[model samples]
Target: MNKKVMSIAAMVAGFGPSAYSLADSQHDEAIERGQAHYLLFCANCHGVDADGNGPLVELLKVTPTNLTTLRSSGSEATVAERVLQAVDGRHAVGESAERKMPVFSDNLEISTVIEIAAYLDSIQK
Candidate 1:
């Protein structure tokens, strides 16, 4: 079994004979991977805090969107879906003469994009 399942089983076996807790191991793993990817590819423009105040923000013509408030922005789509679209270059949050954010569709794997979305979703306020 995977480490996640093993750990959860250990907790159940050790904590109580017939007691157990639910955990989405895949989601947790995705978030971890997403955070690492975000730090590597997005932090320069989106900030480590994801507040759109990264070191390279001033250099761009358009400011990056603050990711923490995305879910509360009243969009019909779920935060994860919106993030997926944005990263895939299918949805532009702030369209100008030219989009400042590069299209990551070709650069990142689909699973990687989903993981990034998962991470973004976890941080939404």
Candidate 2:
């Protein structure tokens, strides 16, 4: 093939759907891991649908944040970064000096935190 033809073909190949597929794979994987962890740790408070209406709501002094609205809630940070901070307990809700959200920074791996964040981001409205 001519140089121009070869270059065009290369460009087209580089822009193919495989790139999107790879990204989608990684995104799906993260979401899967995140969902599992959320179910195990957060579902008791955050709810399976992450609507802040978990079964334990009545037992807690503070209501869990409705995670479905995080993206549209006018927060400056992206959903993932916000979740990371929250999991680390750096983003407390009220000034009560006692945070209801348990800090997972000590027990969970950072990668696990990121995966949980990824899952939360996927469910945003």
Residue 62, model 2: lDDT of 85
lDDT per residue as tens, model 2, 23-65: 7676677679889999998999999999999999999888999
Error of 1 at 120 (Å): 0.6
Writing each residue's lDDT as its tens digit, candidate 1 over 53-88 gives: 999998988888898898798876656656656665
Superposed Cα deviation of residue 99, candidate 1 (Å): 2.7
**Highest TM-score, which number?**
2
Candidate number with greatest lDDT: 2
Q: Each prediction's TM-score against the native?
A: 0.75, 0.77
Q: How accurate locally, in lDDT, is each candidate?
A: 0.70, 0.73
For model 1, the local distance difference test gives: 0.70
